[model samples]
Target: MFIQSQPADPAIHDKALRIANETLFIIRCLMREEEWGDYLREAYIIARRILEEKP
Candidate 1:
């Protein structure tokens, strides 16, 4: 992960970390409702699709 400073291209490290944290939060919320498996499956699918679309 990269963090950009002035005079450098914007880095996506912070954004990536935020997304990871959000995913963990979602998993925790889902687990409380006994929905962790479903949430994980959906998250995996969405992540794969996103990766496939990345340049």
Candidate 2:
């Protein structure tokens, strides 16, 4: 959804996805399952809001 707002920019899309994945990986490695769940949910909310924002 976030990529859809951009003008066919693969670099931006790739970077955003990379960041999201890296964040998830780090959280998984460093956090307890219960605590990480909340952080993961918050990350998803932030991503969703970014996608929902108007240009």
Cα lDDT of model 2 by residue, 1-55, tens digit: 5543445346544554555666888768777777766775566556555655679
- Against the true structure, candidate 1 reaches a TM-score of 0.44
Most accurate candidate by lDDT: 2
Q: Give the clashing pairs for model 1.
A: none
Q: Tens-digit lDDT track for model 1 on 14-51?
A: 44444555796855853665675566556544544453
TM-score of each: 0.44, 0.50
Q: After superposition, how far is residue 50 of candidate 1 from its true place, in Å?
A: 0.5
Top-TM-score candidate index: 2
Evaluated against the true structure, the overall lDDT of model 1 is 0.49
